[model samples]
Target: MTRPLRLDALAYGGDYNPDQWPEEVWHEDVRLMREAGVNLVSLPVFSWPQLEVAPGVYDWAWLDRVIEVLWAGGIRIDLATATATPPAWLVRSHPEMLPSDSDGRRLEFGSRQAYCPSSPVWRANVARMARAMADRYGEHPAVVLWHVSNEYGDHVARCWCPESAAHFRRWLEDRYGDLDGLNEAWGVNVWGQRYTAWEQIEPPRRATGPVNPTQLLDFERFSSDALLELFRIEVDVLREVTPDLPVTTNFMSLLRDLDYWRFAEIEDLVTDDAYPDPADPRAHVPAALNYGLMRSLKGGRPWLLLEQAASAVSWRDVNVPKAPGRMRIDSLQAVAHGSDGAMFFQWRQARYGQEKFHSAMLGHRGEQSRTFRETAAFGRELQRLAPVKGTRVRSRVALVVDWDSWWGSSATESLPSQRLGWLAQARAWHAALHALGHAVDTVRATGPFHGYDLVVVPNLYIADAAQAAALEAFVASGGSVVVGPFSGVVDATEKVHPGGAPGPLRGLLGIEVDEPWPVPDGAAELVELDGERFDAPVWSEWIEASGEASVVARYATGVLAGRPAVTRRAHGAGVAWYVSAALAEGGLVAVMRRALADAGLPARTRIDPDVEAVTRADDETDYTFVLNHGAREVAVDVPEGAEDLLGGDATTGRLVLAPLGVAVLATPRAAEPPFVTLSETTD
Candidate 1:
C-alpha cells in the first residue's frame, strides 16, 4: 500500500489575507479562526505587488509579522509563491510578458491570468521571486507546504508576437523533427498547410482561414506544455531550498485549458478548486468524479480541496447563496472521495475588489454573521471526526482521459456527423461511474497501470504504440479493460495509424473497424444488453469480429442495422470490452456495472440509490460518509452500530437523514499495525 501524508486529521480553515485589512483586525480574525477550529491558513496568494515593489528589491516586514502572528495563534501556514499576478511595474517595463489573443491583440494589465507562458523574462522573474521566498520561510516551523503559482491557465490565445512565434517554431521542430514529417503528420497536402521551410510555420492565428483543427489542436498542446514548464520553473526553485515540502498548483475543475492528467505526474500533490452550482442536479456527482480524478492522478494519494466557497462564489453571473446545510454537505462530499483537507477561497470577504461580494468565514460586518457561526460549527465537527480525517481511499477502477485524443477527436474535419466530441463521451462515462458509486480514477496513457482491476478508455482516438503495449501488458496480467468508440484512429502525430480503423488497438481488442457513422446532434441508435434496449448516440462504429471476440450489443436501425455496437474478447486471464456506439448514461452504467462485477470490483457498500455512500480506510479504521442528496428523508441502513462523528449521537438501524444531510460513521477500530499511529497535528 502507498504511504500516507503526515497530516493528523482533516485540515480546516482557508485563505486568510490579513494584508487586505488593518493590523488591528488581525486579532479579531485570529479569534474567529480559533473559535472555528481553523488550523490551516493559505496566505499571501495575491500579495506580489506589495512584497516586491521594484526589481531586485524585497520587503518581508508585513509577511514575517503575519506568519509569526498566525503561528503564535496555533495555525499552520500553506505559504504561496505570490506569483499569480505580476506587479504593475513588471508589466509596464516588459510589455512582452503580456499575453495576446488569437486575433493577435495584446491584453492590458488588470486581469489576473494575463502573462504569456512562453515569455522567458516572466519565467525568470517568477523563478527569482520564488527562490527568495522559499529561502526566507523554508525553515519556519509553521510552514508545511508550498503553493506554486495559483491556477495557471490561458484565458486567451497568447504568443502571437514575434518572439513567441519563433519559440513555437522551435517547439514544432522538436516535436515533428523535420519538415517532411511535419507535413505528413498535419496532412498539409489537403489544404495547402504544407511547409517548405521551418520558418514558414506560425502559431495558428484567427486570420488563417477556418484555422485547421488538427494544427490548432497541436498549438493548444504546446501552450499547455509551456505553462506547465513555467510551473516547473518555480517548483524547481522552491525545491532547492525546501527539499521536503510538498509542491502543488491549484487546478481549475474541467476548465479545458490544460490536460490535468499530464500535470498530475509532475506535482507532488494534486489539489483542485471546485465551485459547482448549488442548484444543478448533477453538481455533486461531477464534483465527486473530479475529486476521484485528482486522487487517481496521484496513484490513490490523498488530495486537498484547495479553494471552495464557504457560502457562495463571486465569479458567476448569478451568484446564488448555498442553501442551509449545503456548505457542510459539499465539504463532506470532498472527504468522501479522498480529500485530506477542506479550505475556502477567502477567510474574510474582500473589501475593494472583484470578489468583494464573495462569501467567507467572516463576512464584511465582522464575526456576528450567521456564516461565521456555521463555519465555526463545521470546523468543530471536523475536529471531532479527527480519527478518519487523514485516511487514504483506494480504487480498483481506472478511466483513461487523454488531452491529445480529446483534441484530436474534436478537431476531426470529416466523418458522417459532428456531435461526437471527446469531452462529451468522457463526461457520459464519468456520470455513469458516479451513479454507480465506483471510486473512479482518471489515468493518462503514460501513468502506472499495474494494480487497477478494471480500466475504461472512452473515445481514445489518438492511440500511441507504447500506450497500446501498456494496455496489452495490463490485460496479460489479468486486469480487464474497456476501449470504446472512435478509439485508436490516429497516431501520436495526429495522422491515421495506417493498418485499419481502431488502428493500434485493433489487434488487442480483437476487432477491425469497417467504418464509423457520425450521427448528427440528437440522433441516436438503440443497443440491446441483457434483453433491455437502451439509447446510444453521437456516433456508431461498424466493426467485424477478428479472433475470439463476439458482439455483445448491436445497433437497432440503419443500413448496417443490427450490427455490433459493443463487443468483448478474452485476453489472458482478463477481457477487453469495446463499445462501438456512444452509450447513454443509463446504458453506460449498466455496462460498467457488469464489467466491475466480472472483475470482482463492485461497490462494497449497500445501495440506497439516492443516499450516496463512500468509504475511506486507514490502518486504524474505515470511515463511511453517507450523503442524502434527495429532497425527502431517507432511512440509511448502518453497516454496524456506530457514532455519528458530526453529532455525538450513536446511530443504529433506520437512521432518517434530512435533505443534504451528512453523516460520518467510524467503524470499529481495526488492529493497528506495529508501525502505525495517529496524531492530532495538521499543516
Candidate 2:
C-alpha cells in the first residue's frame, strides 16, 4: 500500500474568497497574508454562482487571477470544487432537485448545501463542473490539494421526494438483499411494519406512525450512506483527472447527519471545520477530541484544521470575539492535538451575506485591523517552526468510533431520556482523552486493530459478529480495552443481540448485564474514585458477574445500590474495563487515566495538566509542542538546555508561559528520556 502524505510542519493560512471582492484588492490581500506567515489558502470555496452563471457556460477569469496572485506570493492553494451549492439557475430549472424536509415541505434554495444529494440532475451538474475545473487546473503548480465540497451535512437528512424515495428503496434492497431479510431486520412484525414489497418502505418520518425506532435508526444509516455515495461521485471525478493530488471534504466536528468515519476511509486526507465558543469552559476539549478523532480515522496521518474563525463567528445568536491571545492559543492547541495545518474559515471578511460579519484576519477595513496584526505575527511563528511539520505524533490509545452504533443508540425512541444520547457519550469520552493529552485515533472495528495499547468504545450499541470477534481477539492478545455503557446492546440489524446485554462484549468483559436501571431524569448517584467521591447520573445498567472481572466502582444509592458501575477483567497480558453507567466528567477522566497507565500508556509527566503538550517526530529530530490552555501564567520546567522555536531563547529550568501562550521546543534525539520514547509507542 502507498504511504499517506507527510506534511513538513503545521501548514498555516485559511479560506480565501477573493472572488467576492474586487480584482484591485487581491494584491493587498496576498501581501497581508504573506506578512501573517500564511502558507496555504483554500480558494474559490463558494464560487459556484460565479463559475457557472448560466447553464453550460463557464467563467474562469476571476478564479485564474486569484490563483496566480496567491501562488506568486508563495502560498499553496487547497482548491475547492466550487460546487458547494448549485447555481440559482439549476435550482429554478430543475425544481425536482430540491430536497423535501421530514414534514414534506420542499426546501428553498437560499442557504448553501440546499441541493438534494440523490438528485441525478444535481449530481450530473456537480460532476460536470468538477471535471471541468480539474481538467483546467489539475496540473497548476499552485494547486497542492483539492477540496471536493464544503461541510457536507446540510440537506443530508429528511429527503422524501420521489427521487429520494426511489433511491431509498434501492439502498434498502442493496443492504438487505431481499424483502424477507428486510422484514426480519427491521422487526416489521412488531407494529405491522412488515413489508411484502420493498416499495412499502419509506424514509422514516414523524407522519409514518410516529416511526418505529428500529426503522428510524435504519433510515439514518441509509441516509448517511446515500450522502456518502454522492460524495464518492464527486471524488471519483476529481481523482480521475488529478490522481496525484490529494482530495478531501471538510467535516463538521461531532456532526450527526453524516458518518465521518466512513468519509475518512474514502478521502485521501481528513479535514475538520471546528468553531468552539471561547466562553464555553469545555470549548478546548472538543477541538482536542476532534484532532484525536481525525488522527485516529486516518491512522496517524496528519489532518487539517480546515476552517476556524480567525476571531469570532457571526453565525451564532451572540457572536463573541475570542479574548486577547485566544486565537493564537487555540491554533497551537490544534497543532498540539495532531493537526498538520491550521487555517481559518476566511482570510478576509465578507462584504455581504450570512458570513459577512464573521471574524477574519483582514476585516472589511483591511490590514490596519488588530486581527490582521495578530494573524501575521502567528504566521511568522509557524514559518519559524516549519521544521516540525510532517513529524509524527504517536500514542498507544485508540477510540472505537462506530457510526452504526451511534445511530442505533441515539435513535432508540424508548431510551431513558433523549438527553442521554450517543453523541453526548462520545463527546464525553473524547473530552476525557483530551484532558490527559493522549494522542487518540477513532478507528473502525474493521480497520487494523494492532498497535494500540488501549482501545475505548463509548456507547457502542450496535455490533456485527466480525467486529465482536475482533474485539475479543484484541483483548486476548494483551491489548487493554474499555467498553462504555449501552454498548453491545444490538446487532447490525438494530435488533437486540439476544443472550444478554452487551451481548458480544459480555464474555470479554466477564459480566452479563441482567437489566438496565434507568436513573430518574433529574436524579444522580455518587461513586468513589481513588479517594474522593464523584456524582454521576443518567443511565445505569445492572450486571451480574459471570466470570473473573472485578467491580471497581459502585453506585452509592439506588434500588441496585452497591452494584458495579465500573468493572475490570484480565483477558491476557492486558485487561478490559466495562463502565456500566453515565459518569461525570471528573470520574470519567480518572477512570481512563488509570486504565491507560495500567496498560503502560500513561500521560506525559513533564507537561503540566493545564499545559497541553504533544511531540511530533521526523527522520532526525522531535519537536515538542507545549501550549497553555489556561488563563493565568504557568511556569514550565524544561530540560537543562533546549532551544525555543518562537523566541529563539535558550531555556533551562523555569519557563513562564503567559495566558493562552505556546512554546515549541526542540530536543536532540540522543538526549531524550526513555519514558517519553516508550510512551509514544506503547502499543
Candidate 3:
C-alpha cells in the first residue's frame, strides 16, 4: 500500500533554498513564510556542493541552523537528499561520471543532472549522500516528507558514454537472454544486422542512415529504465533508513523522456512539477489532463502540485507574466483536479543563477511584490478549504495513457506523418471531453477498467495481444470505447502484429486498415459525419469494414472519397467506436457525444470552451470547481442546495463569474462513487 503524505491541512509552499542566502536572511525568510501561511517547504534541492565541500567531508553547520530556525518558526520541511547534481570535486575526480551526448561530446558539470544515469560512480556517490541525509534528519520533528533526487531524466536522460554502453549491453542480456532471442526480437535479419555477440550491439548513436526501428525503441525503453534504476537506488536506501516518512521525487508532468507510470508505482507519494504557459489561453485544458493522470496514478488518490511558477517562467522565448487574477485561478484549477494544494518553484526569487529571472513566491521586491501578496491570499484560501484535503476525484471516463505507445509512435522518424503526435492527439480528445464537462481519469492500457463506463484510447500505437484482450473484456462487460487512429499497429518489439493495423482489435472495432493515407502538406481534406462536413487534417486512412460494423462517418474529399472514416460496432454488451482519421475539434466533440449517449451518459451541451467544471468528493460532500478561463464574464449553473466554500454563501441556479473567476461549490454527496479494484479485472 502507498503511504500518504503526513499533513494535517492542505500543503502550501515552494522550494526553499536557504543556502542561496546568508544566515542573517534566514530569519526574515521564515517570518515571511509564516505570514504567507506556508506550512511545507522543500529545502536544499541542489545543495550537494555546499553540503560536502570535499570528498567524504561534511559541513552541517549551515543546514542544521536553517532547519532549527524553520522548526522554531513552526514550518514543516520536505527535506531533499541534495543528490540532484554532482559536486565539482566529485565530477573533477571522476570524469567518467559525466554524461555524453549522442554526438560523442561529453557534457560538463555546470548544469543539474550532469552525471550519467548508468554511471556506477554516480550511483555509489548518490547512495552515500542519501544515507547521510537519512541518518541525520530522518526522524526530525519538522521533516514530514523525504524528497529524493530532483526531477529524474530532466537533463541527461540518455548518455552515449562507454559506461552507458556497457550498462545497455547488460540490460539487453537480462531481457533477451541469448543472441538468437535478441536477433528474433530485434528483427536483425533485415539489413544483415544480426549480432553475433553482445559486444556487437551498441547504443543507437549518430548513424549513417536510418537505424533499426526496434533498436531505437529498445534504447528509449533502456533510457527510461536507466533513470528509474537511479531513483530505485535512492528509494531503497531511504526506505531502509527512514521507513516511516513518505519518499517522492517530483515528476515532470507529461514528460516523454521518462515513463511516469512505472516510476509512480515505486513512490510512496506521487507529486508533479507543472508549469502551464500563461501565454496560451487554452493551456488549462491540457493541464487538467495532466493532473487527471497524476490523480489516477495511484487509483484516484490526491497528488501534490510540488512546483509551478509564481508568474511567468524564465525558460520560454518570450516569458509572459500571469495577468492580475490569473495566478489564483491557475492554482485553484489544480486543486479542482485533485491536487491537495499548490506550490511554486522557489520561495524567493534568485538574485543570481540560471533561474534568476524565474518568478517566485517572493519576487525580487521581497514581501512588497504582487506575487507574495497573491500567494498570501491563496494561502488563506487553502486554509478555508481545509475540508477538501483528502477527498479524491471519482471519474467514470478513463483515458488510456501508454508510455510504450507514446514512445514507439514518435521515437523513429519513419512514421507515416509527424503531424499527428501523441500529445496532440491526446490533447484534442481531452479538450473535447473537457468541453463536455466530464471529469476524465487516466488508465494504463493494461489496467482494470471496472470503475469506468467509457474508455477513450486516444492513440495506442504500440499494443500486444494482452492489451487488446483487456479492451475486449472492457467492452464485453457493458462498457463503451473510442479508439483514435494509427493504433494496434506494432507490438512491444516494434514489429508489426501478425495482421495489419487494429491487429487484435479488428474483431472488436470491426474494421481493417487497408493503408494509412497521410494528407499532403498544404492540402485541404474533409470528412462528413451525419451530413455535416468537418475539416480533417494531417491524417486519413483507407478503412474497410470486416465485421458487423456500422459506418458512422466517411471521407468526403481526396483519393479516399466515400471511404469509412469512422466505424462503430456492438461487441457483447457494449459498443466500440474507431476513428481512422484525425478529425477536427467539432467532429471529435460530435463523435464523443454519440459515444456518451451510447453509454447512457449525458454530454454537457453548453460547450463553453474556456469554462471548466470538475467535481471531487468523498462520502458526504461534493466539491464542484467552476473556473472561467475566458476574457469575458460567464454564468455557471450550480448544483441545488450547494454552498460556496470560498465566498461562504448559498447559491443555486446560475452563478455569474467574471473573467478569470473561480468558485468552489460544496453540496451533499449524491451516491457512492465507483472505485477501481485492481484484482477485479483481468488483463
Q: Residues 506-590, candidate 1, lDDT per residue (tens digit)?
A: 7779998898876667677788888888887677777888759978877777655788888888888888999888888768877
On a 0 to 100 scale, what is the lDDT of residue 318 in model 2?
89
Taken over the whole model, the C-alpha lDDT of each candidate is: 0.78, 0.78, 0.89
Off by over 4 Å in 3: 672-683
Candidate 3's displacement at residue 126, Å, is: 0.5
Global local distance difference test of model 2: 0.78
Per-residue alpha-carbon lDDT of candidate 2 for residues 268-349, written as tens digits (9 for 90 to 100): 8888888989767557766676777777667787777888887889877888888878888888777766677789978889
TM-score of each: 0.92, 0.94, 0.98
Sequence-dependent TM-score of model 3 = 0.98
Order by TM-score, highest first: 3, 2, 1
The Cα RMSD in angstroms, rounded to one decimal, for candidate 1 relative to the true structure is 5.0
Pairs that collide in candidate 3 are none
Number of the top TM-score candidate: 3
Error of 1 at 166 (Å): 1.8
lDDT at residue 282 of model 1 (Cα atoms): 61
